[model samples]
Target: MKARAVARVLGKHVVMIVLMMFWLSVLVFCLSRMAPGDPLQSFYGDAVQSMSTGELEAARHRLGLDAPLWVQYEKWLSGVAQGDFGMSLKYKRPALEVAGPLIGNTLILGGAAYALVFALAIGMALICVRYEDSWIDRTLCAAGTVAFYTPAFWLGTMLVLVFSVNLHWLPGSGAYRPGMAGDVADRMRHLVLPLVVMVASHVWYYACMIRNRLLDEVRRDYVLLARSKGLGRRRVLMRHCLRNVLPGIVSLMAISVPHVLSGTYVAETVFNYPGIGLLSVSSAKYHDYNMLMLMVMLAGFLVIVSSILAQAVNEIIDSRMKGAERGGV
Candidate 1:
């Protein structure tokens, strides 16, 4: 029975992933091809203008751009099924070759930002809940609202100005010092500003969501009973309220991961961080269709994976909630 349940869950997620990939690939391919300006021209530069008609046709054929849109998409889709994303017109390299190094860089920067955001958002939300409409809660809510509305680029620029230029405390941009791969301190110094900017820009939204949810959960009968049973304020909030609130938090965090990864374009560009977000911007500028499509597919994959994980977590938490309701705790 357990095996059957697991299989059923896997099958559901697999179907969702496959259908999502199909539609995403079709939309991405069509939109990329529809964009103005010839990728061949961008790839070849001034030489493209000087080429004979026959030479241009040959170049197009070689790049598979001469094929009909449907045919081109089918061929690309086939390659994608086998984990191939074709070649980068700009770099004359495989898509993976161009994207592989940048993935790790993004994961490092994004992962750190995500961890800080998750931890601090929860902590801040709890504080707000504890204070419960006091001055501190009002102040935090206002600040979080400001942070949410503030453009990431503006925030990043302000950090650079104050910390790097005025205070001389942190590096303004780049991942690390030149030729300092093993210098942990220097690398951390470079990371501090961008990391803070990413965290500050994102934390408030999640914190606010958590605060509202905690407020609602605290009024539930279970929580009231826990307080009546001689549980202290912190105990009731942390043990009874937080436990029930955690699944929602997990779902929210998981859903935000893909968005955070995708949204890093502004932050990464501002910091000159060598991450996939920066790579995507460059690829878009150079009309590197293959690279751009690969990035899209990758982002989709992350969303699908996170969704599956979140569903599993939700199921587990639901079961626990049911058990608690049945006095089986």
Candidate 2:
């Protein structure tokens, strides 16, 4: 029975993801087709300008761009179903092939920044909770608020100016120095500015949420009962309040994946990091439909999957959620 219930839940999530991806693909395909741009320019560059009408038509036919919009989408969708993402007009390569390494770079940069942001947020939240309404708490709150409101691009640019332009302390762009790709130190240097931007733009928001949640939890009747039973404030918070609030924290983290992912993209663009974020920008600018489609679909998949996983985790962490699911089922 348990196995059947789990299978039912998995089946539902799978259907939801498939439907979402179908709609997302249709939307992106239609929008990209309707957008004003000559995809030939992305493919042929300056030569596109020199091509005669016959030559242009031949080129379009060769690239399958001469087909009707719906037909083109059908063909593209068929190719996608077969694990073929088609060619990138801009890069003159398989869309996934061009994006594969960039995806890894994005994972590394975004993953590092994400982990660091949560770590700092959790630490700061604990500090604020301990300090309560003291000067330290007020100071952190003010700083976090300011950081939260700061635009990512502006923050990244400022960091670049201060650390890269003026002080010459860090490499301003790319994942690493060109020839120093194998050097972990060089890679870390390049990551510093982008990481700072990502962390600053996101950490405070989560920190404030956590701080508020912890404060509220500490005032609960159960927490008071724990304290009345001769528990120290620190012990009560760590053993009772913090533990009780963790499931919510996990839920919050999962819900924020999309938000945090957007911040990572912004950071990537500002830093000129060779990641899917930068590739997405260039693909859109040049009307690289295949590349754009892949990026959008990949991001959408991540968002949908993360939300599903979060729900599943919540059900596991809280028996009430499982009961509710069972009742609904």
Candidate 3:
């Protein structure tokens, strides 16, 4: 029975991932076709504002832009299945080539930002729970609430002003220091401001969620029972309350990863970072439909994977809780 349940859950997860990928593929394709820009004209918009009838028709035929929507989508799907999302007319290169590096950049930024935020949040939550209603707890709560409402773009501007413009501690607003070195230190320096902005945006949000959860758990029956047996406050909170609140936090982190990844678009473009969000915006403005589709697929994939992780964490939590209940532990 256990094996069957596991198999069933895995099967459902796989099916859901496939469905998400398919839906995103179709949605991007259909919407790209629905866009008002003439792909053929936009393709040559720089070269000619006005074209003879024969030239216009030839360009349309070559690019197949005048085809029926369904036919165009079908052709696009066929190319996608073969791992060729067509070429970017503007860039004169494969879309995957353009998307690959940008995705790499995004993952680096997202990973650093989330790691710092999540680690600090858990620690802050523990501190808040340990102090309960003390002055420190109250202060953290007030500060976290304010930070939660703070905008990333504004935060980026402030960081630039204080650290870069005023103090000259870091570069003002761009990804890399121009023409210095291509080494790790150079990359780290470039990443600092954007990463700090993202971390600031996320830490308060996570700390608030975790602190609330831990506070709620610490007041529950299990925690009180643990304390009644003479367990120290640290032991009871860490071994019992924190454990119970952890499942929820783990699930939240899974959801937040996708949110941070997609929501970084504005931040990336604002900061002039060479990440997927900015790249997607550039591709989109230049009518690089292939690259646009790639970004859509990448975001869809991240969401689907996060959903699976959340589901798996929930399963483990429920199983453990049930075991503890049966044992009266």
Candidate 4:
């Protein structure tokens, strides 16, 4: 019975993700088609000015731009099914090959930022929860508010001014110093400002969510019972309330994936980091529909996968809690 229930949940999430991907592809395809400027023209650059109408028509046909929007999307989607997202119009190479390195760069930058955000958020939450209703809690809450409201770009710019320009402490931009790309220390130094900005951009939301959820759990009957049974405050929080709050923290972590991706857009651009976000900026400037559409699809895929994982975490935690209750009874 439990196996059947698990299968049903997995089946539902798979169907939902498939439908979401389909609609997301359709929406992004239509929007890219409607956007201004021809990618071929962007690709050809000054040469576009000299191309004859027939030449332009041939180029359009070769690039599938001459087809009806639906036909174009159909061709693209078919390619995607075969692990090809079409070729980059600008680079004249497979989109996957061109985007491969950028994806890895994004993973590194986003992964680091994600780790820092969770660490700071959980640490702040624990501190605030321990000192609930005190001045420390109020101070942390205010700081969270500030971080939540501050634009990532502005914060990154200010950090650049202070640390890179004024203090000469870190490289102003790029993934690494031009000649020092092979140096681990140099690469890390270059990453610090952007990583800090990305973490700051997201820490507040998670911290607040965690703190609020934990506080709510503290007021629950289970927590009260634990405390009344002679458990110390810390013990009650750790043994009772904290476990109950894990699912909420997991949910917040899953939901924050997109926000972190968006923050990467700002952080990468501000720091001139050569990641998916920086690629996205350039793709937009060139109206590279193939690259842009692939990015949109990737984002949708991440959100769907994260959501499913979050649900799984919730189920696991809830089952454990139920098992604990049964054992206690």
Encode model 2's per-residue lDDT on 115-209: one tens digit a residue: 99889998999899988999999999999999999888888999999999999999899998778778988889889999999999999999999
Which has the greatest TM-score?
A: 2
lDDT of all predictions = 0.86, 0.91, 0.80, 0.85
Candidate 1, residues 145-248, lDDT tens digits: the string is 88888888898999989988999988898877778857878877877888877887899988989999999998888878878888887888887788878889
Off by over 4 Å in 2: 317-329
What's the distance in Å from true for residue 126, model 2?
Answer: 1.2
| TM-score for all models, in order of appearance | 0.90, 0.94, 0.89, 0.88
The better-scoring model by lDDT among 1 and 4 is 1
Name the TM-score of candidate 4.
0.88
User: Weakest 10 consecutive residues, lDDT, candidate 4?
Assistant: 238-247
Top-down TM-score ranking: 2, 1, 3, 4
Q: Could you tell me the C-alpha RMSD of candidate 2 in Å?
A: 2.9
**Candidate 3 C-alpha lDDT tens digits along 139-224:** 98888777767887888888888888899988765566667435668778878888777776678788888988988888889778
Q: Which model scores highest in lDDT?
A: 2
Candidate 1 regions exceeding 4 Å error are: 221-231, 326-329
Q: Candidate 1: lDDT of 72?
A: 96
lDDT of 4 by residue, 1-329 (tens): 99998799879989999999999889878987898887886678779889999999998888779999889988998899999998887777887888887787788889899989998998898889888989999999998899888988889899999999999999889887777768888878988999888877789888888888888878888778877888888887776677767777777787678888888878889999988888877877798888888777777898788877877777777898899999999
